[model samples]
Target: MSATEYARAVAFGHAFARRQAVRTVDVPGGFAVLDDEFDQVHDLNRLIGTGPVTAGELIAAADTVFGTAGLAYRQLTMDGPTGTELVAGLTDAGYRADRELLMAYHGGELPEGVPVSVVEPATLLDPAERAWRAEAPGLADGTYRQLARQRLRRPAELTRRLAVLGADGTPRAWCELYLSPDDRVAQIEDLLTLPAYRGHGYGSALVAAGVAQARTAGCDLTFLRVEADDGPVGLYRRLGFEPLGEARQFHRAAGGT
Candidate 1:
């Protein structure tokens, strides 16, 4: 498998553990179980733990679970060479498909800030700072306070801090540096900038700040993801991050539209 593919798999496995607070167990026969409230079996490149062996078996079992709980499940994709039979099985079974991109960085020192001081994200949750983050383009979906509260409710099992680009009382950008329990690695999450503030270098500064913070926290490496077609790929590459892996994202709505 390619390095990119390998990195992507590791990233997903890392994120999956965070999102579900579960562990990926190494079962027999080159397979593993992502044991959440609903256990899923998959191989390296990712196939549902349908039967004991393949996607087909897993889907057959999934029907009952999804029906009974009204739960929507998705195929757990992995990285590297997976058998075509598994893809065919999922397609034949009507599983939805989508794609995601992964990136990683190593071997570079984060540039030191000359004018601005890198501070902890928790500081920004203060009322005025929260207002600034809420108005920030990337965080427009919700308030910074709301998101912080939601995150704090969880066991900080591997939660990253929310860092913002600020001078005086205003924030120019925002990003999160978090940890993954399964891999014990730090990762960049929720990197965002206000659309109007894009050209000033705040994005780079924010990422650098995140990396520096993670390193200070004793993390060995950092990871982040971006859309394959997005322009940030170039920016990230320039910052020493490279393609690590690829993934598929599947989503379905209540209305099924």
Candidate 2:
């Protein structure tokens, strides 16, 4: 069958990971992304896809690769499951899966009536503090901060960061827009807003700014991926983004759980 838009977009994501991963090794169906520097950043330290291999072999390889690095866990990212056997096998093996939805912008107006500007990724730290506390209340203040910092550390030579700043000059909302090497695809990632600032229209404003930037770059496809049942799905739909695909990520947090 011909590849769906979602499949093409998934390929684009894997290509990006391969292009920037500090180290990569061929695995059964695809490869593993290994960046010890961001070991805790699961996306930077997980398997990128799956193929026609037995679940036991896949789990063993993943454990070895990650375990050898002292990461203590195995994680896998793949487009939605194709067969029940593998999915059932992995589930029985104790790997938990989470669904992530990908949506594509279908050309339209967005409520950017608010001001959103391109900003240094470093500048968002102030606004991100609230996120650290709200999202991971049990984590050490430093750990949450560290996680946020690590995300910004990703390869960004092809990215533009956008933010909506309050009158006091602190970011109320922010997101990252990444244009593909050929400028044909743009993926809006890491959209965030502080807990106390939720209703200020910052999210839509930031998205609008990102879409504008994508159009300016002549990117033919603009998309955003978020966890299923996430709050922003409705907002994205209202802004003209339609479902393109979904990814199912299997995670076994440190020590086979």
Candidate 3:
């Protein structure tokens, strides 16, 4: 990763945690984000940051935090050398690992398809269930719903909740655009479109809307994060996004997946 890309990723993650976590506790390497009320919402409750610490020490610190908070699972994502090096140790200790990519706009702009409007996260729930479950069929119904609903906990004004609604007023596609122009970055997160409605290009339209809006807001760069192997990477590339860097995620499910 270039220093610029790496720094952007780290800065966004740190800023996001500080603003969203119910409570953040200091620990070796970085900090533990705790939010018992969210029922293990990984983004709101996980270990973040990377300095230097053994996998054993990292796991111990994370477990202590979750245990004290009565959380049933644990998640940690580190986008640095310390995290990259801990992959083997974490997997050996039975944690599931995921590789994620940080991408930035390079040039592909989609043709305008649909108009998107600001809306509450809940407004997209019906279509989201159809879209997300098809993309991540492995997650249980309740888990997927909970994951999507996690955004609702935040103040509605935090991010621009953009969506393309169906004829009946339900959103057919949705996403969140968080503009932090002072940081010179605008993050477009969690893009989803209903399964049956996808071929019509709702996904690309959402991306276009976000990119145009973010740039209009004076953000120097627009970025998105997703698992390295996710299918949407192709679509995003078609819309001008290219790989910036990588991040590693180590997680243990409630019953230890």
> TM-score: which candidate is best?
2
lDDT of 2 by residue, 1-257 (tens): 12366666787788888876889989887789887777777778888774566677778778778878788777888775546676787889888877888889886778847888888878876567667777768866666666677657556777788888889878878888888748488899888887778898888888888888888888878888988865578889999898887777788866667
Q: Name every residue pair that clashes in candidate 2.
A: none
- Model 2 has an lDDT value of 0.78
Report the C-alpha displacement of residue 121, candidate 3, in angstroms.
3.2
| Candidate 3 whole-model C-alpha lDDT, 0 to 1 | 0.78
- Candidate 2 TM-score to native: 0.91
Tens-digit lDDT string for candidate 3 (58-164): 88888898889888788887875544458888887779998888888877646684778888767766666666677678877677777767777654445888998
Per-model CA lDDT versus the true structure? 0.52, 0.78, 0.78
| Residue pairs clashing, model 1 | 4-244, 8-244, 8-245, 50-57, 50-58, 51-57, 51-58, 160-177, 160-178
lDDT (10s digit) by residue, model 1, range 138-239: 743334445443433223555555544455645556665666434546777666666666777777877787676667777666777677664488888888
Q: Which residue ranges in model 1 land beyond 4 Å of their true spot? A: 1-68, 72-85, 88-96, 109-150, 165-170, 180-184, 255-257
Weakest 10 consecutive residues of candidate 1 by summed lDDT: 39-48
The residue ranges of model 2 lying beyond 4 angstroms of the native Cα positions read 1-4, 181-183
lDDT of 1 at 203: 77
